[model samples]
Target: MELKKSSSKQEEVEEIRTIEKPIDDSFLITWESPTDPKNPKNWPYARRWVQLVIVSVFALLGPMASSMVAPCLDQIAERFHIENSTEKALVLSIYLLVFAISPMISAPLSEIFGRRILLQAGNVIFIVFNMACGLARTKAQMYIFRFLAGFGSATPMGLGSGTISDLFTPEERGRAVAVMSLAPLLGPTIGPVISGFIAEYTTYKWIFWSTTIFSGFVFALSIPFLTETYPKTLLGRKARKLNKIEKTLKYHTEWRLEHIPQRKLVAPALMRPLKMLTTQPVVILCAGYMAIQYGILYLVLTTYPVLWTHDYNERPSIAGLHYIAPGLGLILGSQASGIFIDKTFRFLKKRNNGKMAPEFRVPVILLGTMFFPTGLFVYGWTAKYHTHWIGPDIGAAMFNVGLMLGWRGIQTYLIDTFIIYAASSTAVACCIRSLAAFGFPLFGQTLYDHLGYGWGNSLLAFIVLGSSIITCSILWFGGKRLRAMSDMVIFKDE
Candidate 1:
């Protein structure tokens, strides 16, 4: 027993010796090491911007595919001999439904295989099915193709944030995010406009064909430029290179390729996001707010045609052009948010003694809440009373501005709060929001039919207003307490 105990103690000491300790001397910080060059954050700005553009292109393709089909839904249904408008609407919104569930798999896969591989693979999947969508002859075929395309398209949604975090420091992320964020919002708004013109001039199938061509272009462009950006993946590569160098020099380094546990790569990749989603209060609150905001966006999208065509007697082309107003709002709002979010973060960092907290972004949410109900009331009442087309357009623009602001605030807050697990954290919020986007439109027509546009929209506005107020209040007071309790923050401190 005494011999065994001595051997165990000796083994423990040897293990401790193998682990490298941090150098305390400040002079060592100035040394330029091989590892320094490999860090993505230190990469040339041109390379970083190229990566940003590639990921943004991937992000843009998904939303374009989603909404491009909107203008052609009637023609698609008629060709298939399906008469129900609600069922036809399902073909368009069901893609978003598939998107909600796919990230569960894709998010984990990105963590496992690396972001670039999954992104490229997903783009291929999207392109194939998107082509199938053009060739779909039956309603069942269309639904299946759209669902598969959506699954493929979900890759960029979750991976874009992780990529940004990998490549940019938190302080520099705002502008990159601004460009990336524009893709998804602007894609949907512009897709319908372009598709409407195509549908009017040609067959409905061209809508799918056009997106297929776009996706092909993106895929070709991404092949050379896209590279793995995840930290674990990059670090593993570095460790391997270091191991080879140590062998050549006949000197042992502290980091050993054999010492890295296989499970370290697998376990955290799968469990971290799930843990963050289930455990974090901030994630829960932000997710609920995002779900409501996305729901309202879809509600308006699904009902706009009903309001414009039936109530106002506008042509499809003209009605589609109306989307441009909201597109303009989203662009302007996103650009403004990029500037303000960074500025607010810096100001709060200074105020907090140079320590930045996630709660600093909450002010933007308050601003968004104020606009939420006001826009809804304007849109609802104007359309209900048969007011001029410009009135509803203005209302949509206002509502979209609020949506963009709220989205940017919540997204940045989540990323700031859970830097290590932001991808999974954002995934949870996105899942809930995508589900709402899918479900809200299904019932939008029914609610408008019975309650009329005015009262129905009023009810929606009230719900959003109440939720927004509650969200703002919670962030204002509870955010500080919650941030202190967060595991990510605790981990960072240690």
Candidate 2:
């Protein structure tokens, strides 16, 4: 028997050969053919886009909730009798703490159980606990509810990236990953804007309540529409279905069977993200740069309300509107990255004998390196001197544009590099960035207090500038070599 290759360009579905196999034999169960409709990569553009939209919406909810409370931290602080900046920031940062932790568990589990279940379950958990956050009367209740809700929120962060990896090929992933990623960065910006007005006009509790309500609608949409896409899990299901037909006879359950003892699979699956983080240079550098970018983004977001409300003497409502500046910039970055990343990949692929490596994604971040620090320098100094509000907003928009480009580039590169274990690789990145996001804001007030906005932000800007250089150099000059040495297969476009 001869092995059949995929027609779409990569050997993505090698197990899914054209020739049929006996389920009772040792052959692996897979899609019927290269063009099998069941294969998500082969899904029609319309169908895949629907999945992208649903997951992106689910993805948006988590990061949105993470920062929605930013505009209303003061209101909550007052209600709970909290008196310190750290504690006030705790109300927001506690959510991010778990946001860093849950992806390790969720991403690995998605590899085991499938993506749909994790996405839906996490959303339900978010809806219930988020509503509880709105209902909480004490700081204790709010903290617990927020932490649990964060776990729910972050589940989609890893799941969404894995889903995009499952649904799109390396060539088509630029646009898909851009949309999937826009949620987390863009969500924070969108969140504060909505909550600022709600907290000013209505009760601060409405912030959680409104998101919970919107989450309910998105949850409902996910229930009927979202389906499993993990190639391994789908193969397992297909094998089980075949097994039921004739129990007395054997099936080709030996190949990629899912009946492995949970004891055996769980520990390794859960550990994979940590293992990669410690062992893989590509993962470490991608996550490191991303963490710096994420940390600074949250630091700015947490303090944005104060900048406008205190420095500019604006009301909470008007202060909240400033998020739109960064929000639009984030959109601009994502759109621009989406447009050029694939084109760049194709151009590079042509230059390199019609083969594509994950390193092709790194060039977009070079543009990010330029914008991120410049925006930081401008925003920092302008806010320090109390320049017109528009000056700071423009600076914010510019940095945010950099944030999106850098973030999308790294995320898509990881997904492409570790195609089979995309979820685990993504979890590693999420875990690191979440930690940064959590820690950065906790010290943001103190940093600004000591150094003032200009120097403090400039410090962050310079750090990211340095990190971007290391990130680009490694990926551009050494990414292919690093990936070649990796134990996992490095997917390439042919």
Candidate 3:
């Protein structure tokens, strides 16, 4: 027993010494210089914009597929003999339900395999399952296909912001995030308008078919342009190339392919977002704020059919045209926010002697919060009194503007806060917000039915006003301190 103990101690000491030894300089992989051209951060402005445009287009296609079918839910319900209101709503809601869940898988996988492969493959999955949705004969089949398609569609949401963060620095990221984030919001709104026309002119199946073609186009463009941007991934490739060389060079990169873990860090990667969600107050508040916005957006999308077809006695095709107002609001708001967000951040940074904080973005959200309830009030009251059709449209458009502004603010904040883990952080935000989006519409018809648009939306406005005030206050006064308290990775300087 004494001899064995001594031998174990000697082995332990040797192991410790081995670990303490410095890694050879040759094995160390690093950028060649501060201005290395291969680094995404060093890419030319035109090239960076080209990458962003490609990603943004891919981003738009997924959500377009998700909500384009909104206008066809009634036709789907009648054909499938779906009588239960919840079941009818489930046809749409279930897609969102899966959307909330799939990011758990997709976001972490993107981190492991790099963004391009997962994104392109996920789009393909989305294409296949979404097309299958059109062919679904039974209610069960529709539910399954929609869920699977949603599972696939969620990849862009999970990964797109990370891609933006990869290409742009925090100082330059605001507008890029705005463009990437706008895709999902804009896609849902634009979808129903097109679907309405298709619903009027062609079979509902064409909706799925048309989107498939569009997504295919986006996918083809992505294939050639969406290069791998993950640093470790690029280094791994470099290391592999070095190992393949037959001659031993006197001077060569020290990076070793074997140093990277053979097994994917699956368990820890999967748990990170949930861990952040539970431990970080900033994530909770921002995610909750975004969720409310998403819920409201979907609520409007779900009820447009009811509002125009039943309340105003408009033809379905014309009713679909009304979605254009909100779509315009989204575009204008996003564009305006993009232009201003960077300016806001820069002006604040300059005031503080060139230091920027995530809290700097909160003021924009304050403006949005005010617009949120005011627009709701305008929309709800106008629809209640049977005013001019344009009244409700204008109100809805205002609400969308508020939504886009708030979304842009929070999204930029999240990407900035969780810079290294942007994908995972975004996935968490998307999860809760997607849940709100899923459940909100399930109860939308009933809420409007019981309370009327004026009172119902008025109640929503009050709740939003209260929540916005609280969110702004917390982030404004305590955001930096709260970030300090958490163990999550945060950049100390922009």
Candidate 4:
């Protein structure tokens, strides 16, 4: 009996020693160590929430910079002697073009370098270029600086959702996503309103100067708070630290003479998103739908100033206030989506024997599609007829509501489908949407001129409604089959 007891104690000691040894280089371990405080998932709730808020603030700054100049476009045109409205709108829209394309470079870089570093670095670049915008002496300088600033700003747009995914579980992700998602839409809405008043009180230069100052403050705040959240990068750092300690301890041991193996970084980490973009049918469909919806939004935004100032004879400040209607719609729609997205997931999970498929997000998308064109039609007809101002505002609000709902549905669905590659997937979607934002406004003047506001907007509404209907129908019918068809769905354990 004593011998057996001794053997048991020996085994316990061996197990403890094994646990203390460094993990194998080949083993894939998730960040779940209960003692590892560096793991974001294990962070204190307040700290994690604060980190999320900071990331959201970074997210907000990008969109705010994008749209802050919208209210002051006329003044910019007059100052620079830009006679063409299309040329004036291009200065605003081209920033989005840069936003669309820059992510192709930035997203992959984040995967390689790490999120916090790239995000902070990008902010510095953005701040410099944004300040340059305030000092521009000509239209060329303004255009170039805006584009460069946009390129720097795209980092947050691509990585914000990824940051949330890194910290939150699938069940808790809805609220985090709600907050992250709100930043992009809310920034655009609030930017113009505040910028309008600022422009009214001061000069066009202050718009750029104000954003630069705000960005600098956000950048300063981010330094201590935003730690590296990428799992591979964190693990790599931990391994390096452990290696140094192990080497120091092993100096007196026989094992010290042998060479240590270095971990090989996977190239696929940089290439996976592009692979997914090319091969993933779900990504393609969702991206296409998102692009169309975003294009329509930008088209309306570009035309809004022209309609208010030229048609209604409203001053720049009052015209900018009109954006509030869409702002209200966006908030209402986003809140409703936050509640319903999870509810829909729960209902579908129950229906499918407690298994939830990503396809469950499709139903809300159909509802959004129905409202999209209806809102467009109302706004178009009301504006063309010179109807009551409330009519157009209500129409704008309804359209914004539909845009938010559809956007949230598609975004949640993509994240669910590609949780591991959610950032890149989102980046791909954002790229197309940003392209539309850049290009749609350039043509807005021509579209309205040829067809007038009524038919011009009506045409766009018809196209968007038709596209949404087709895309949603395809997803509603084929989504289950598509999910079943993909190896990703079969492999997903949670």
TM-score of each candidate structure, all chains considered together: 0.88, 0.95, 0.91, 0.86
Over the stretch 264-346, how does candidate 2's per-residue lDDT look in tens digits? Answer: 78887888888888888778888888888999899988988989988899988899999999999999999998987889888
Clashing pairs in model 3, backbone N/Cα/C closer than 3 A: 26-254, 27-254
State the lDDT of candidate 4 residue by residue for 149-247, as single tens digits: 988887888887677756765445566777777788777777887778877888989998998899999999998888887654565555555557766
Best by lDDT: 2
Off by over 4 Å in 4: 1-28, 32-39, 248-270, 480-494
State the TM-score for model 1: 0.88
lDDT of 1 at 161: 75
Instruction: Report the Cα lDDT for residue 354, model 1.
Output: 57
Question: Model 4 misses residue 328 by how many Å?
Answer: 1.2
**lDDT (tens digit, per residue) of candidate 3 on 411-442:** 88887777657788888899999999999998
Ranking by TM-score: 2, 3, 1, 4
What TM-score, to 2 decimals, does candidate 2 have?
A: 0.95
Judged by TM-score relative to the true structure, which candidate is superior, 2 or 3? 2
Q: How well does candidate 4 match the true structure in TM-score terms?
A: 0.86
Q: Go through the candidates in order and give each one's C-alpha lDDT.
A: 0.75, 0.85, 0.78, 0.75
- lDDT per residue for candidate 1 within 1-494, as digits (tens), equals 01111221222212122212235422111112322555576688899889988998898888778888777788888899878877888888989998777776667667656789889898999999989988998999999999999999888888777777667765666677777777877887888888778767888888888888988998998888888876556555545565576654222223332245555766666676666667778878898999998888887876776677678887788778988988887887788778877787778767877555667787877777777677888888898898888888888888877887778888877776665456677777878888999999889988999998789889998998899889888887888777666675421321
